[model samples]
Target: MDTTPIAAGTGHAEAAAGGGVRVGALVPLSRPGWVEAGRQLLAGLELGVGDVNRGGGISGRPLELVVRDTAADPAKAAAAVEELAGTGVAAVVGEYHSVVARAAAAQADALGVPFLCSSAVLDALTDEPTEWVARIAPAQSRGWRIFADFLLGAGHRRIAVAAEPSVYWAAGARILREHLAPRGGTLVELDARALGPAALCDELVAQRATALLLLVGTPEPAVPIVTSVRHDPRLADVLIGAPAGQPEFAEWASLLGGDGAAIPFLRYLPEHLSPLGARVEAALRERLDEAASFVAFEGYDTIAVLAEALRAHHGTRTKAADFWPHVTAEGTRGTISFSRQPALTAWQWTWPPIQVADRDPANPTRFRVLHTG
Candidate 1:
């Protein structure tokens, strides 16, 4: 229970004295970005550790978490990984930002430590040939493809993509275009960064687009865009899709108020909840005192996967390459397998489950799962 802040340069002699397996958790705890998300991930990490410790703790030895604050910066994230390596953590987990996770993965590879990326969806994160890096979340391209399929299956021919100028959004927009074009569908690309929300909505309506995809980076732009489109009577039939960015958060529905109703978004886990998922959600809700998000579930699952691998190896520090086979075979969310295709790297979770969900008008806290793939 004693979580004394360990300085970056400190030795791990004290932490290892009790024969516990130290696991490093790298998250953006400081400000300037993603503070809430980092906290939620940490909460899940702690809960998973608690559950592991309760159930005889990894070959009867306790699991200790060494926390490091990445502050959402790539350089800091890389440094955190190096520091965690020096501190002698058996493995590392928990990074929400894609850029930060990419940098940290490189550091972990160099250090020869296993890194379980919790929520970063960048395709290139797993594209590099590194045995040290593994991802529990699906790649962004896969999520975009899921969204594209959902839109097209609903008989939508004309699709419009409104995206901000960022690597994540750009990648998503590109995937949408490629998938839709081949299926005899047309895509209208709009730069939400260049145009205000009202202007973007006006342009989308003018295009007579049957489906509008918002790939904006944050909720700031998405809120107004969804609100504008939902309120307009002219765009009543248009399906407004907020893929990957804002709608994933639990706060999105409350922020958008009634306008958030019936707007579909890409979700890794279903809101209706599986039995195991319900138990995890209940624990998180008790700890956080509010509804838990998908990121929290991801954080818990990352640790669960790592613990499963560790237990299989009898608490020994397994090599990154050796560890993933066990993970792919025994992962909690079905089988956490990977593909070695050239487009994807060795550690990418190839068979990740995805769903298109929209908020319930009567209960903003719950999402109605429209389609699962």
Candidate 2:
């Protein structure tokens, strides 16, 4: 499979002719479902490349991005990995969907190429025993805990969890149940795929649920759920939330229109930006002509971490195992240090900062920071 090269106005031909270090980006740029997300992720990665190139790059060699459109498909993602492996990129990064990340991880392992997952949150993406895969995003378990804590702190005792049957959503739901049941809080579980949005709203109201924790994995299902709940007068006051899911993206708000107001979701970055975060945000705003989302932050940080690792190894250690230590060290977003005692994953970013933000009705494009947990 052939992949496109986004040179960021740099010398694509010169870079490909042994003038730069190549890094592969696997994002769903062509698929109708994930096009916007792919675009934002690509923008963040390009910004990272631009910054590195401006700083004389790794060991004075420029960083070139070889872009591949995963199209949100697992098979296509794996194929892209195989193609990138053959192309001799120093590392690979960028995937929004968990399933695609899993596929890309497996292919990266088979091909012995290092893969830094930017935004995929499924635990299994790193759970499998693979030396080639590392993730910059916190796993679903950590995200669920943050969401549950936020709900409990907000006095949301009676909560409803609306989740689809996907592995990612199911894991989040299980974590929520385990965390909330012991705190003297009640949880009402609803199958999003089994029930219509209106029926789900009715169920939430009947159960006297004060908050609806939506674990729907994507924006398509979330739109209907958010709209149905908002339109129902009985459920108007119900606090709707998700565990680092659809609500973090601007497209989710756009799809729900005015109904997207006050929907909360967990984010890895804090409400108040760090000095580095503020700089990155400014760069993103200037380049993309829009506010950066959490996904973009993850994208930028992932590439930044990879660039740091490449520089630390002096561009000689390109193998996954060779760069694992440097990649897990401190980074721009936060310390990406991994722990094996708590989990088996080789490089899982433990204890990443998480915050809950809600979309503003007045400005659906911008989210209002609610609480940083």
Cα lDDT of model 2 by residue, 1-373, tens digit: 3556665536777566646888899888875437777777888888988877787787887788898888888998899889988978888899998878988998888788888899887777744677778888887777777788888999999999887776666777788889998997888889888899989988997899999987775666777788788888998778988765566666776677777767788777865677878899998888778778778888888877888888887755365666775455444566666544255454777766777778787987777777775
Q: Give me the displacement of residue 322 in model 2, in angstroms.
A: 2.8
The per-prediction CA RMSD against the true structure, in angstroms, equals: 3.7, 2.5
Sequence-dependent TM-score of model 2:
0.91
Q: Which stretches of candidate 2 lie over 4 Å from their true place?
A: 316-319, 327-332, 335-341, 361-366
Candidate 2 clash pair list = none
Tell me the tens digit of each residue's lDDT in model 1 across 1-373: 2344332212346435547777888888876557778878888887887777777777876777888888888898898888878877788888988878888888888889889899888888744688888888888878888888988899999999887776767788888889989998899999887898788878987898999988775556778788888878888888888877466566776687777777788777743566667888898999999888778878878877888888887766676668876554433355566555456553876756788888888977777888888
TM-score of each: 0.88, 0.91
Stretches of candidate 1 above 4 Å error?
A: 1-17, 270-275, 314-316, 328-332, 335-342
Lowest summed lDDT across 10 adjacent residues in model 1 is found at: 1-10
What does the lDDT read for residue 102 in candidate 2?
Answer: 87
Pick the lDDT winner.
2
